[model samples]
Target: MPSRTPSSALYKVAFLWNLFWGVPLLLAPSLASSALGLPQPAPGLGELHARAGGLAIVLFGWVYLTIGGNPRAFRPFLPIAIVAKAAFFLLVAFVCFFHRELLAMLATAVGDLAFGALFYRDWRAVR
Candidate 1:
């Protein structure tokens, strides 16, 4: 097997990060929201939305894992992943800016920004 590059390692880190938050959000939306310093999600619709978000996050993690396993083969998907990260970060930052109470989410949003930058670096490197 070939040696892994920094980009591969980065994606692996992202995978772990997603799992760290996604699992709890999936399993316990209200509890997870509280743990993350967000107000508890309401029942029914709120919980449903949280669970859906969690599933999306986990799926995104799977994409990162696949890309890490074969960066060249997965190169085409990088743009979409980068866009997703950027969009997530932007949305969170926008919300947090308007609602100070959601400030705790800024950390995770920043993480996505960092990953998006690293992913862009990887895209350039591979190209």
Candidate 2:
């Protein structure tokens, strides 16, 4: 493996964070959503959202971990990561803009944006 970059720490942080957030959603959607200040989904919808989102997050988290190991190969994915987070940010912003009280969900988007920025910064530095 190549030597670790300045952003290696950031990648690791994002990896762990994603595990923390994603696993629970995959394994315990109701609990995770409740803690996040999200309303309960209609019966089956909970599992659908939880499992799907969790899978995405966990899978992407693995990608981030891979980047930590071999950024030269994975740094190209940074832009996709940014798009992922930006999508979340925009979705949350739009929803919260109308609901007003569900702003707590924005926290997740904030974290995503921060991690995305870190990835972008490191990708640029390495290039």
Q: What is the C-alpha lDDT of each candidate?
A: 0.88, 0.81
Query: How do the residues 1-127 of candidate 1 rate in per-residue lDDT, one tens digit apiece?
Result: 4443545788899999999879899999988998988888889998999999999999999999899888888899888889989999999999988999999999999999899998887776764
- Candidate 2's residue-wise lDDT over 1-127, tens digit each? 4643655677788888889889988888888889887876557976887778998898888888888877778778878877887787889889999998799988888898888777777777666
On a 0 to 1 TM-score scale, where does candidate 2 land against the true structure?
Answer: 0.87
Q: List candidate 2 segments past 4 Å from native.
A: 1-4
Task: State the lDDT at 51 in candidate 2.
Answer: 78
The prediction achieving the highest lDDT against the true structure is 1
Q: Backbone collision count in every prediction?
A: 0, 0
Among these predicted structures, which one has the highest TM-score? 1
RMSD of 2: 3.5
